[model samples]
Target chain A: MRQPMTALERVHVTEVGPRDGLQNEERVLTTAEKVALVRALVAAGVKEFELTSFVSPRAVPALADAAELVAELKDVEGIHFSALVPNLRGAERALEAGIDSIVLFVSASQSHNAKNVNRSVKESLRDFEQIARALEGSPIELRGAIATTFGCPFEGNVDVRAVGNIARHFADIGVRYVSLGDTTGMATPPLVSERIWHLREVASGIEPTLHFHNTRGIGLANVMQGLALGVDRFESSIGGLGGCPFAPGASGNIASEDLVYLLTEMGIDTGIDLPRLIEAAHVATRLMGRPLPAQVSKAGPRLALSDCSAVPTARG
Target chain B: MRQPMTALERVHVTEVGPRDGLQNEERVLTTAEKVALVRALVAAGVKEFELTSFVSPRAVPALADAAELVAELKDVEGIHFSALVPNLRGAERALEAGIDSIVLFVSASQSHNAKNVNRSVKESLRDFEQIARALEGSPIELRGAIATTFGCPFEGNVDVRAVGNIARHFADIGVRYVSLGDTTGMATPPLVSERIWHLREVASGIEPTLHFHNTRGIGLANVMQGLALGVDRFESSIGGLGGCPFAPGASGNIASEDLVYLLTEMGIDTGIDLPRLIEAAHVATRLMGRPLPAQVSKAGPRLALSDCSAVPTARG
Candidate 1:
């Protein structure tokens, strides 16, 4: 007799909405508002949070108050607070701000790297190696991000082998975790699976993470495909912020609340409180003075009939 | 030795954006505009198009001109034009309108069905059986639609077995095709796959279709999972119109242009011209006096590097 289908595994969600989301918005959020949003998300049981970036204020003005925000959020507990860093300088700043982890970004596409970080893939690899060596023996865990892994707005379709090679390089440099970004939101299911499969093969032991954009509206689709490949870690923005600045018309990252809702509805234990997360999205949307691009913000939770019937409503 | 991973089979895309799309829009489109939109979609090579719904004008006023629109486009060759029907009356209207294929909808949740069609599931199923008998030995192909298959806004989570039983009933009544609708956008990937699999088992030989709402932002993710389960047909609204009236906070269906773009990118043959479909979306948006919720309309196509490099301007 054939074996019965096994129960699906629960996936871990790493929410980057606050950091990646706010950084790409036209309006800059106050430090207090950002902290409140973060607190709301924490109350929703989001353990992995990308708090902010420590890049130059000139490059990302929205995140210029990163240091102050991190300092103020020092009291928040039971969460993994991380920050994005460009080089050793940014890493040092994040470390000084008492962040638990730091993320380092490099592009899989050479052209995208040049346009996004003003560096080629080879040059970025070199910088990453230096940064990794400098951060050795620190309490902070290092994560390598490979942007535009699936497709690039500037370069078009990126080679799976190229992404695999980059993942291998990160592994070789002693980085335990790496994130593959669909920077321009060009990844679909097959491309997502193929790229993740190749990266897993090349990295051998390092765990792979996914960073998807809903630009073309396939962010969650890509996430499902990644899950099929046993990838549980993901990077999502709250209210879908942090769109591509270089690619015109590209929207922000995938919405964290949306992703969490998906995972939870699948019977996967994401440890997130759906209603509270939606409330957090509202807080972020108010800060932006407009609707943030989260689907769940407009559409409430997908509740079972029993749950809906139990809740008494004035409209009903 | 482990078997090498088999590549996923190609998925089919049914573009219902024109018919199902306009039916839910507040703006009523003229017959000429509707024909132009359909013609543009045909030029873009959409094979299966849900042309219009033949429901009563009093019930769905937005689709009041369905017959006139169908009569005008009778000359279009090599495309399958299907119509939505409420009961035998709607089916007769569709047949009179020269549409040979019809999609019949019934909600899986009793409360949703009563709210949507003003009837319970048992009443709707009895009506469907009568309609199926009437269409027997005719050229008309009846497609049974189970709305709120994933989750009911009024109900919460729907039982998979309940959906399967509904599908079995439709199959036994000689419905050739069945579509499970995530009316409130509550479907996660696992839920989609589980429901589709169970429905397939219950329906035996009948092929399953999917109608997804992008309300929770997991529309494409649900589509991806459905595709993985060997589902070929999908219902999408152009510019993502046609939000569920019964399901509070539910957004529109998935955008047809965006779905086509995703399928074509994955090397799946959708026979859809992305640019031309986008043009059709623009026409629809103009008629609606607001942007339809299409991601591809706002964001351009995902191109290869060679394609992007050849383009003169970076941003479309």
Candidate 2:
């Protein structure tokens, strides 16, 4: 039997297409296109979004409008627009841009951390103290992420303890929400559940979300595992577009429409309109100048009948 | 916590590449390539295979060698090779070819039945009675599949009672093994579990297997759902290649390598070598003249490690 979702009534989604989705694309979107994308997502009932990255323009040129984009949409009602900040300087920039929440990341695997951020995990965690102190007593919210928590390209089978300790340190620095990243797409269901269970034991103060890649095509299985643990927060791309090019995984995120189909079919409210999300995917595809990798968008929804009585069965 | 696998010491897999996989391809494989594919699967310790279909050559020209393929490999040791049959004539042909096992299918939806096999669901069920009578005293084992058990393209949501009744009738006709086909990839985890649970009571004598298509990208999640219910048998294709093109769904099966990756990671004994299966997938790609839709084949396996140590943290 499937695990009963008696305790879980709704699932929260963090639409990460603007930042994570565009970061990996060869084609960059104009600031206007970015705004349009975000607006469409907001119109689709997306209450949460990682609107842009606060990293250096030289590092992520695609999101050069991080500050301008946030400033333009700062007064948007009912939506939580968060930005990804790689350091205290990025945090300062995000705050200057009037961003209310920020996501900071450090890899659980040392090699990935050095390659991803040019720093070690310890250095990254130690540097968190500065960001924590900087944000002390501020209205801004901080969420931490541990990449390669499931598996690593350089270090295979990352010990859950390493990710747990990093998560624990994020908690120590007053971070409340954290996510375990499958940067290299090494997440299986059992592995996902195992790490989530480890988090429950080691860092109960932190609310854990999951960021999965569709590299080997078990992203939803990992999400389902998180759901089994009553974890409903998922980070996904709009058109299922994106992956860290150097992340040792395939370039695909779990599609918003795909995840929405699973969520809505199970009667778990995502509050985002699935068809509108697919429309958002079409917008993303046009901007990226390539077809995205999402399944539901291309194949149509699982049950797409408008009038059941009008549908013709093949009996004739 | 992940589900325990105490009772599920071993799981059975039916490799359906030769029939289901090739049937949906534009490039029809030569008998030698087909034989080589099956040989590689056998070498990788695959103990069961659906080698071909007894459907007419006009219907599925790719599998015109139904008898030829079986006749070539019938003497192979220690593997259960099954052939799909549409009617008693096909069943007789399979038995004539000395096929040890045969699979017959009837869609649970009337529209799908009309389109797929040119009969109503009731007509298909009634015809199964003739196939049953013809095979009653034969050595050939019989299994039944209920297509569209989850949902129908023409009929939006297939009632569990409707599918349960089909499964019960299959069991009544002395079929001990029944598979539920996600013909249009309409299976969510909860829907899969619900239908599977109902099958447990209505056809307690029947061993249920799942045939999933990765049309909407939750195929693996559905498989994990079946795994949670202790349903150990699954039908998958090589390289995620194959689907009924006419079947109102996408063109990918849950890739054998991806499935093997999940199974081996969970300590589920599939008895097949995962890496070797991937190698076979490469061979399949070469034969198909184009890459198939499976992610693992192109992205490669999940746990890719190049260096064992010396990964530096982000700190200076």
Candidate 3:
């Protein structure tokens, strides 16, 4: 039987649209438009955000105004904002931005790491060590993410130990929240269960956050497995804003509205307003000038009724 | 924890592309093109199909050649073919075409039933009694479907007992297979479990075939709940080829390739050739002259590795 909603009543959702979603889009929103987007979601009661990334503007031109966007949003009350940082330089910039947290990332697959950052996995880990040392005793919290934790585009299947090693590294540095990224949407139920169990064995104190993409159309299904395992934290984008730069026509992040719909329908509490989230999704689609891949926004809330006389009827 | 794959290994998937999928489309397919589509799915190891509807051509012109399609596919070995029929006349046509079964449908909601067939639910059930009597002692199987089994478009939430009553009627008429149709994509995981449990108590002998739409993006998540409840049979369409004419912009059916991918990844057996299924999805898209909503077909298989030199890499 499926897990009763009583077992896991509350879940934490981190909206990643501003950073992970927009980073791959060709159309770049101005800093003000980005601020407006965040405000819309904040009105929907979204308090946790992967606000932006402190990567080189030359590398990801879509998010070139990351610091400017953060500066505009840093004073929002009762919100937890975390920014992705690649190295010591990015980490230092994030700390100076006065955000709530800094997320240091490394790819679990060596080939993906090299392709992503032009460095080997060993070098990335060494850089993370320096970044962790730099953030020591800072008020801003430190977290870690392992990309390509499920599968790699350049390589076929990533080893479990590769992900475990990164989690172990994060645990060693006193970081507690570790995110497993399905960078190319290769994560599945068995792989998710296996990885969570492996992390329990290797780094028992670390709380795993599942970040899945709807690339293969099983993103929410994977979330079901995560919920069944009692894992609650997840990451999604508004209107499913991101697509994989490596895999053309592949979706990047699961849509935030759809994720909330799934959790809310299951009777789980996320402290987010669904109608407001859907309203935010419309703002996102208007910002992009196209329909997004998120289904819930297009379909409306489950109870949004239709007029019988207005719709054509079919026999089958 | 998630159910292990070993417990309920083999799941049966019924392809409903020919009838339920195309009936809503504006473009009418020639009998040959329909035949080609069925052949493509057959090549992908699909053994069960809701092949066509024996409805009036004036009502649904897209599937006007129902008898012709059944005549074309009746000779295929080891295939189970079923057709949707609204009244005694359609049932007679389906029986004449030598189909394995005939599906009789009625909307669980009164307004939907009135809109769909211009009859009340009671009148529809009385009509089913006549059809059942007409097919008495015949070799063809009788199956029943209740549309709007989850939430009705006009009405908000459907009572579980309303669904149970329909199932009870189906079981009373010697119908062992009853399909719960999420006609407008109103199904959620909790609704699925509740309805299934209610059916078990009200109509214990009848097995449910879940027919879900991807309108809200949790179609596969609902399948996960069905699988958890040990319900093995499901229905999907190739390329997700249908849309609800009643609910504009909402998707009609879950894509077959995506469903098979989820099952295969979870190590559950659906006896499907995924690559071949993907090939069929491409054929479906070509036939429609547009991109469909299926994600896996657009994303490719999980192991379809990318060339490092040809693709762009992102830091996040």
Candidate 4:
């Protein structure tokens, strides 16, 4: 029953259900439900949790209580609770709430930046200078997330060099981990691989993690190539929840349970309790009053065929 | 827009919706609709198709028109239409119907065979002996499929050596191509890799194709590993149709359209037109009177980004 019993190499997972997933969902979970999920995730052996986002309530109402949520989980033991900050004000709120880690966002595509944050990519980087200076004396660990790094819906085929420049900006500010978000779930394996390679070549000091969506049904395949390329970290959402707030019925992130199944079966340690994580997904479904698109939650785990000697294949 | 524009590998896809998909669904299409699907598939550039199963109508009402369906498509030029044969009688019917390719099934796990066919594994092997002798020089290309080769839903954790033994048995019967069926969708990449290695070590002359179910959400991931293992042939259902007849509500085969998306993007030549394949999936949902769980069908094939100068990250 040990986590990573087979997966010898450790694979770090950042659970983003509370932030990325809930933000895109029409259902706004109460602070208590959100807290319950984050607590359950930590209990399920998650080491890192993107606990909340400190964006303006006007922008992402589901995460309106981001500061309060951060304050509540900031002291949770055995996990790194982090917050997503859209700008300097969000960063201030997260830092003031005593959060130890923060993830900043910038889109690799210029049009995405304008549409997503109402700023050009260059304008956001200029704003980053102020945000970076504000975090200079803060104890927070900063990470940069470049959304639409794989393929931008608006721009299409985002230039890999654009992603590197964003990574360079983060590296310049002493951020050690930068995530490439497949925001629209348009990432293919080759696209993911090429981006990671280009990022590594440019930001040799940063650790690259792939955030995938099962929107096109190859999220795990994209992760497989990422794993093959030696990516040690990934970001996924519980229950495969979330889609663009504007795009209803589109899938969110790769389900954490499905990702764990892939990693654990490959003898790569995720160190997460898969069944417990699935239980959390079930709870989310009950809370959301609908089934989220997490497949392992429905199919059960690889049949764990070891416990059976008597044939159940008749009704199976 | 050319296939194999970069991924030079030539991959063969067998569309199995009319057989594998329909058999597991509650709805049964009429003979004309079945013929229409076959014709549309042929028009969509499907060179190989599993059109029907020759089992008794009583056992599977979904495929009661097996004879008619096979006869309708058997002589379609530019396509090799095949049927599933459950026993000696089934094979006789298929051969008489002029279907030149037949897929014979047996379970690697004893209990699955018993539950699936009410026969023991050894008994099926004996049955194979008679079926093989009957098909000798009978204008048929015989391919053996070892179901539950990865894991058995009833028995769970089916021995890989047991699978190698089954492959060896097929090879002994003059069957040159054998497929390893993830009957319950329990395959992981490492298990797939190890099994392929073991199967090759034991049955060197036989070519292996991977049949995957996306029940646990890694169907395409499993296929990616199979491709990396150099398995060039695959069997998939359009709209991700077909589940184990016994495992209701469980996902059936991986969607052929989704598989084509992966291959075409990787620059591999599937020869099947991607858009046309998707249209066929749409036809399936329309005929089934419900949406099939095909992701790319919902996501719209990577946005083609060709029209983008300004990123349209808004609804994307």
Candidate 5:
């Protein structure tokens, strides 16, 4: 059997808690609190962030202050900030905010696309084209996010060809960074390998980002599969902030601190400080006013030793 | 890269919820409740179980009724039941209860062994000799469990030679099944591969079972590592019942439903029913009167569809 990739490989961890994690939450955080969360992560050596989405305030009240949150942290140095954009208007607003990148999303499953964005997959792709045209000569980069790329909640087992077709559209528009979203936490190891294989064939030269949710509790397992396939980019939420509205109690995204801890222990560098990242997760938990789903934050790192006297003498 | 093991490979999932799970809980279940949990899993096609442990009632108050629980579950046909035994006396009790196997445990780290069972590692191994003599002509099989096989809380980073020497001792005593217990959730992918290699060199023909905790939320990830190495047998708890007493919010064993779901999705045959196992997890949750750490039971399976109409219109 082949050994795992050595410590020489660096993995990029994109923190998406402010955008993807907060959107599904019932409690809306203030712009200041969101800035605090982002600032805490930035101090933890986090370089990339999916900050917030420039969508209608009426649609996602939780992220109503997206632009305000962006402007609050505008002076943070050396950090790449990306925001979700639904159309040309959102893209233009992101440009005015001086965001690093604008990610245009369309679900691979048509039914989910219609339900989520109220547009067919083709219409969403068309909107992306308009956004791309608006940024033709701009310094900002264009990225594509294909939601429900693994499996659709409404339509189960999305075809790999659907993902490949969407990737082809993104690549055609000069979008090199495309993220495959497991919108409902339906991603499996085999499906991850299959999609990566399909992307290599159908959308060559486009870098793929694997964004997985831990709703089914195998999100990190899927990450291992991605690593084994030599795919390095990953996206996660701090403190596992998001919970799926449809599934009632299901987890949303894999926790950023937990992901960083896993990468660090595997000798894969993510350029993030694990202990400081855990403190950021604690900040998110405190602001959320509840315990987040993250384990490492609660458990501490593997070597965070306890006083032998502190442990109760019991059957282990 | 080599592909994952195919569907032709069968993995053995040993349900250890009744034994390792309950032993750590503060709330004690009635013997009938214990029997019910085992029967529910048996109905779910789980063939092997670490049903309970025959230890001193004073030492483990929660599992005080281990013998009674075993006797209640004796008539369950076609199921292989094992129990943890501390010494010759406990092993004799397990034999009277007609258990198929008795697992002898010692910590790879001497400090942990002393802290846990109030004995030296050498003393524990000597006790195993008496237990082996008690079962010399008996039909019951002997299995070995090495706690803190990856790392120790009191002594960080246990040497692989310690684990190898223990496995060698177990093999010398006519034991073929040896479980390397990640007692404190310190097993990483590299450590797992390293220890497995060590065991292969020293212990030779013993079948190794990988027991991991989700303390830092990477239990299933370790399982993927094990699968890639062609090791099939795994041990997990129902509903992730056990939590580390030392680490307040740390999860103990990986949830059985989540483990089985990952295996099934990977096209590996476990011969375990997913939905029924989930129902059993629900029973455990209800009995605990609090939510268990298992995610699959709460999220449902991947294909479990919701009425598209019931889904609230929200930003993805």
Candidate 6:
């Protein structure tokens, strides 16, 4: 077998920590801190940052300052600022806040959708269509998100066909990108590959980005399988923050710093600098006042000896 | 790509938690407790168990009771009991303890060998040859282990050819099985596959088993990659016990319960029951006075509706 390509070879990482990560934290970050975190990530050469969500304050009080945070960071350059929008109202809010892109989420599992948004899967699809229609011809790039694409907390095994149907529908509705979310961290490598393959088959030429969680501690493994399937785009939170509030027992998203370390070490080109990302992880960990679930943050990078010690020290 | 076979379909798990795991803990488990843990694992359908090592007491004081423990459980049927033997003396001791199967460890990295066993790689190989020759033509089966096959803690980025050379040397010395150990948990899926492929090329017809550590938390992912490569036998510790005294920064070996759970859930065949393994984990945890590193132990098996109250009612 040949050596696989590094992140720089094919994939582009989209950092979603500031928005998706803090949106679920109990101690809500102030708008200033959120903006500062986003600025720090930008300084670290992160090209894509999901800033915040446009959901109702009651639903995600942690992100109530989404508009303010985006407004303050309006001058940051070289970063695509995106926001998660629940529906047309969310899309309108995001558009008004000057976000360059909007991400709409639809649950692949019907029971998950009913519990999360109080809507059936079809109802959520209709909402996504409406949001897509509302953003027609706008500068904002409308991206669809299929949450719980691997397996559902409410529904045991999610059919890959169901996920593909949603992806095909989104593609038909003119959505350019679809992210398959392992919302409850229920995905293993097999599940991740199966779903990605199904989506690739159904929506030929339209590749969906992968979003994984480390709740069950297999996030990096899932990422490897995704990479093997030729997926080049991924959504990850810095410091491994982010989880669905409606999904019980869900933990943080796959940490961006850890993901970058894995990719860069594999000789994959992820434009993000690992040391800078690690510095950002320190900031996030301090802000959270607890350890984040990032493996790289806890365990340093897989560095070469020249990079590690530089001296010919005797082995201990 | 086809779905990788489920854990129930392809793999047989060998629980190494008793020997490799307890050897690294600060507190030493009594010989009775170690025997009980092994008996519990056997009861849980573990076919192979690495009971203990015959190393000097000064080196690994935790397993000083290897002889007594083996003597206590001589009548356990349907289980293969193996022991780690470092050199000719250790091999003799293991044989005296009635252990017909023995695992000999040799470091692939010269730096690691110098640090770990105070011998050069060549010296270690010479010692391995002596041990293999001594056991030749007997009912004893000697297996050679190439440590740090993927990446080394001291050397960093071990060459796959070097590992293959060591494995080939072992094959020449009448060793039937060669096990590749990721001594430092630094391997990714790609690295795992590459090493397995190289080992297969170098040592044809000698079935290789994989020993992975979850220190950096990608153990199962590496296992998945190995499974895809047609490797069927693996070494795991109950409740993720085991650490390398030689590998300073390394963490526990991959958790047996978690590995079994991953395999069984994926429909692979380990022939081990998870709940019973968890019970073994509980015994080990109680002995250790802290929870071990098994992921499935902390977070139960990956089920869709674990918390659903209606499941019991519906089943009734």
What local distance difference test score does each model get? 0.75, 0.79, 0.86, 0.79, 0.87, 0.75
> Which parts of model 4 have CA positions greater than 4 angstroms off?
A1-8, A244-249, A304-316, B1-8, B244-249, B304-316
TM-score of 3: 0.96
Q: Residue A216 in model 5: shift from native, Å?
A: 0.4
Best by DockQ: 3
lDDT of 2 by residue, B187-272 (tens): 78888888888988888989999988787888988887788788989989988877545433355667888888778777788999
Instruction: Quote each prediction's TM-score.
Output: 0.89, 0.93, 0.96, 0.93, 0.96, 0.89
Chain A TM-scores, candidates in order? 0.90, 0.92, 0.95, 0.92, 0.95, 0.90
Native contacts kept, each candidate: 0.35, 0.40, 0.52, 0.34, 0.48, 0.17
lDDT of 1 by residue, B1-316 (tens): 1111224435556777676666656677788888888887788777788777776676666677888888898899888888878778888888777886888887788888876777778888888898888878888888777888887877777888878888888888887778777766776776777776686677786788888888778888777776666677887877776665544434588988888877776667666778888887877777778656677777777763322221111010
lDDT of 1 at A93: 87
- Chain A TM-score of prediction number 4: 0.92
Given the true complex, what DockQ would model 3 score?
Answer: 0.52
Which is better, 2 or 4, measured by DockQ?
Answer: 2
Query: Residue by residue across A1-316, what tens digits does model 4's lDDT show?
Result: 1222133388899998887788777789999888888888888888898887777687667878877787677568767888878788878888898787888888999877888788888888887788889889879888888888888888777888999999988888888898888888788877877887788889898888789887777888788778767888999999888865544445679989889988877777788988888888888888888778777877778864422222122211
Sorted by DockQ (best first), the order is: 3, 5, 2, 4, 1, 6
Q: Look at candidate 6 and tell me the lDDT of residue A160.
A: 83
Window of ten residues with lowest summed lDDT in model 2 chain A? A307-316
* Residue B248 in candidate 1, Cα distance off native in Å: 10
Scanning candidate 1 chain B in windows of ten residues, the lowest lDDT window is: B307-316
**CAPRI tier of model 5:** medium
